[model samples]
Target: MHITFEKLLYREDYQIKLDHIVMNEENGNRLALYFRGHTDEVMVLIGDYSCNYFELSFEADCVLLRSSDLHELDDGVEFNTIPLVLYKDSALLTFATAWMGLKRDTSRDWTHYAIRAFEQDFHVLSPRPPVFTDLGHKMSDFTVRHSFNLPTES
Candidate 1:
């Protein structure tokens, strides 16, 4: 399918492939998605750039975009690699901002870190999980591509 995101068309099976990775491939339920309801649309946090907003576009299509990065506007956002947090048995999103209103940066939420007025570093916090009644809905675009297994010690 050709996905139309930010006036660009991306022909890739993104959601299907991602769903498969999150469900069957991710071990020990360590994977989770960080989603934000941006206005009347939705976007999933997919990167860890402090100055760049890397997310999966859900406005009219599903594609990666650095919505806030002006430097890459001409070059276009890089969607090949995404930043993540490695866990003991799995990996997941680093952090994501919880959308409130168009307020000050102090209130904006992020997973990795947050910059304050006086502080140049981060105001770190724990990841806020969604209260999902149906857990399957989180990765509903289900599919089975490949299953990987490790060799056990004899």
Candidate 2:
């Protein structure tokens, strides 16, 4: 399953008004799988830009995720990392650690820190490598494939 935001609308005051959300899925499992896949990407992107952060809010049936206040090192280095806070309703689940980075920058100084809450019970499955393609200058694309096992009778 894949979801895309073809258009996004903002008010004159710079507030988010509406977003056109489109979902593509072949089955129920695929839909669920897509949601998980989407969250994984969001988390990774947020984790990369060390100064940028995101908050994920969930309602009864929908999830609201927002990223804001992007910052970077003063040396004019274009860092691609983000700080993230995960929330389910009013509960905080985890504070992202500096576990994400390119293979070369594996040192402690370049690594960001993360913290997890004791009250939350969450699981992040291993991520499969994404398929990336260049879409011309300054543009790129990513795709992740997912498969799941069928459930058995109780």
TM-score of each: 0.17, 0.16
Q: What is the per-residue lDDT of model 1 for residues 1-154, given as tens digits with 9 covering 90 to 100?
A: 1222321112222221122112213333333333221111122222112111112211111112222422432322233211222121111112122232212354433232111111111122323322221122233233446658866899
Q: Rate the local accuracy (lDDT) of all candidates.
A: 0.23, 0.22
- In model 2, what is the error at residue 29, expressed in angstroms? 8.8
- The positional error of residue 21 in candidate 2, measured at the CA in angstroms, is 7.8
lDDT string for model 2 (20-94, tens) is 222323322111211111224443332222111212221122222222211221212232222221222121111
Q: Which ten-residue region of model 1 has the weakest summed lDDT?
A: 113-122
- Per-candidate clashes come to 1, 13
Q: Candidate 1: which stretches are off by over 4 Å?
A: 1-16, 20-76, 83-101, 110-154
